[model samples]
Target: MISSNTAQPMKDIYLPEPADVLKASPMTALEMFFEFRLASGRELGHMPGQFVEVSIPGIGEAPISISSSPTQKGSFQMVVRKVGNVSGAMHALSAGRQVGIRGPFGTHFPVDGEMKGKDILFICGGIGLVPVRSAINYVLDHRDDYGHVTILFGTKTPADRLFTDEMQRWASAKDVTFMETVDRGDDAWKGNVGVITTLIPKVRLDPARTVAVVCGPPIMYKFVILELDKVGLKADRMYVSLERHMKCGVGKCGHCQVNGLYACQDGAVFKYSDIASVREAI
Candidate 1:
């Protein structure tokens, strides 16, 4: 028999692209958006807090943060807030509607082996919780891999809260400390009635051994970082996920550029130290 390598040059086999609309389903009021699930139980092969770009033929694409954890296989979730044209179009979509996806992109919040066994303070504001929720769930799923897990989450109001069902579960989770705040309140709203910063002072944390993962509106980051510093958390120990109008999702499009960093490619997640000088990062 002829040796395979010497007998014929390796040939590249190209496959047709798969359909864009992932496993689309309506869950509660929010569309339960899924991108890549196979009936065979194949995993998304993603890291927590990364994102995927979803596209429609005529409407173009948008970079959406993956809200599900890597621990969840077979599918990934993206919580679209229905704020823009693409998202608006997505809102009208029904189950099995085809949408294109390209990603699992951006640098994930550092969960290096070193981060294991350290205390974690997770902070989220508004729908900003959507992205950070991935990391929080990943850590929570592997509870023994770390020490204390404290989550400080806030929303514009109680009605605007995302992941309500999951939040209830997390609030009562063993060994996890969960707190929430609302900027404005309705008659039905109880719990903390102030900015998320108000809740920060109540959860005591050891700054030396703690790492903070924060995501929120641009305004919230500036104020929250100050609070974290006041409590003695180091800049390097704090990470933030930035929001910018990203187009290409691969850094080629200049839409998501903040100073010299591309929020699409270089980040959507950045450590405080990495972009300290980037005035526009906030």
Candidate 2:
């Protein structure tokens, strides 16, 4: 028999770890904000733009993007929309409830890597804001590490806004430029009303130093890329998080394959220039 000290530990990649819900609250009619802490008391080491597989015993498991920044200590967060069985079950969970978490998988935004010293322009539409928020907060926490910060958010309606309180705080921050719009407005809405691409032309930045991050509904990508190109932002300088049916957090499952690349293993976040040649990527 091998000595216990010398034997390598075998870890099961498919087994889920237990995590306790620290807080659960509604962000919108269909979306719920969940904060969880690993039962083992360790931080969920993850980077911005990565996703985790959240599972509820008998229901199912779904890949949800990690919404909180790594700078946030103790616990991690996810904004879950009640779109299916697993997410519906997740909505019923509250603080103290325990669930299974598989991974913080996929490639992440280069926040501390290539992004250092460069200006960040965040363009998010609808639920797309969830993943990008991680990078946004990371930049804010280490504000001095980067150049300027610009955030543009657009949703279907004013009532559909997520993180209203945080949006106000971001807008009020000294060095950050925050702008929001809605496709349609209500009687109380006073901000810009149009698709998110319209806001791109209004902001001024040096294309040489600016890195644009875009995430939103599937239809939003092509139009947003066009708008960014018109504003002098090169495809190489832009990054996007593509939405796919990622069944397994690891690449073994072929569910999230786009062309020859696996969204789960290769990327959920990819440089526009790199994936531009892949027909299904955009």
Candidate 3:
């Protein structure tokens, strides 16, 4: 329904359009980043947090988040963690390979709506940073539009981190406060050590006008929500992305159902107030 991307919108939700792989960079042993330019030669016109269904002609299809912002024109980015057959096939792609794309599906972070004029607190653990980074960078690109911003990142170990170069820039910047820690540290490590939730209480922010966006592993959600509440953030002020078994991204199937709602149709990005009633939604 949203079309900031100038490229052609999907003519058929079940039929995928061609998108070429311009580059593929390894982020970790299992995760890799791919930059795509639609065969239509149009921008993906995707919003932060929206996902696209990537199809490998003979292999199959998988849904991946748009890691880059529409603010960065021309193309979009996706970081895929290879945990199955489809993702493994994606990891095998090179610079010139072509893949099928179906969407910029589901709801997204409200970059132009509730997010405007508000301070932002981002909590990302491990691969969860993929979508969180999209919102963070959009706020950074238009720095003057928002108030104070804070970023907290957690990794399993010192060696498992992603985007080391950009991480350093965020750490050193005066405008944005960035904090990081690892679950376990080695002899070479000297920094905060513990769960991601440990870093949440130390930072102070104005919860009245702040929006906390969180994404990571499923288990991390409830604890993060508990911590955000401790900091005085109201239930409605917190937004979370729920991962589900996605099949029909357009809601025709009920694969990603939470409560009476379909995650694909109703939301994958929901206000805590909207989904708190569902015990499994966190």
Best by lDDT: 2
Q: Considering TM-score, which of the candidate structures 2 and 3 is the better prediction for this target?
A: 2
**Model 2, 151: alpha-carbon shift in Å?**
0.2
Error at 69, model 2, angstroms: 0.6
lDDT of 1: 0.80
Model 2 lDDT on a 0 to 1 scale = 0.94
Ranking by lDDT: 2, 3, 1
Residue-wise lDDT of candidate 1 within 65-138, one digit each (tens)? 98888887767777787777888787776656666666667889877554588898999998788888889899
What are the models' TM-scores? 0.88, 0.97, 0.94
In each prediction, how many residue pairs overlap at the backbone (N, C-alpha, C within less than 3 A)? 3, 0, 1
> Could you give candidate 3's per-residue lDDT for residues 5-99 as a string of tens digits?
89866576689899999999899987899999999998888888888888988888777888887789888999999997789999999999899
Worst 10 residues of 3 by lDDT: 4-13
The residue pairs in collision within model 3 are: 5-45
C-alpha lDDT values of all predictions: 0.80, 0.94, 0.87
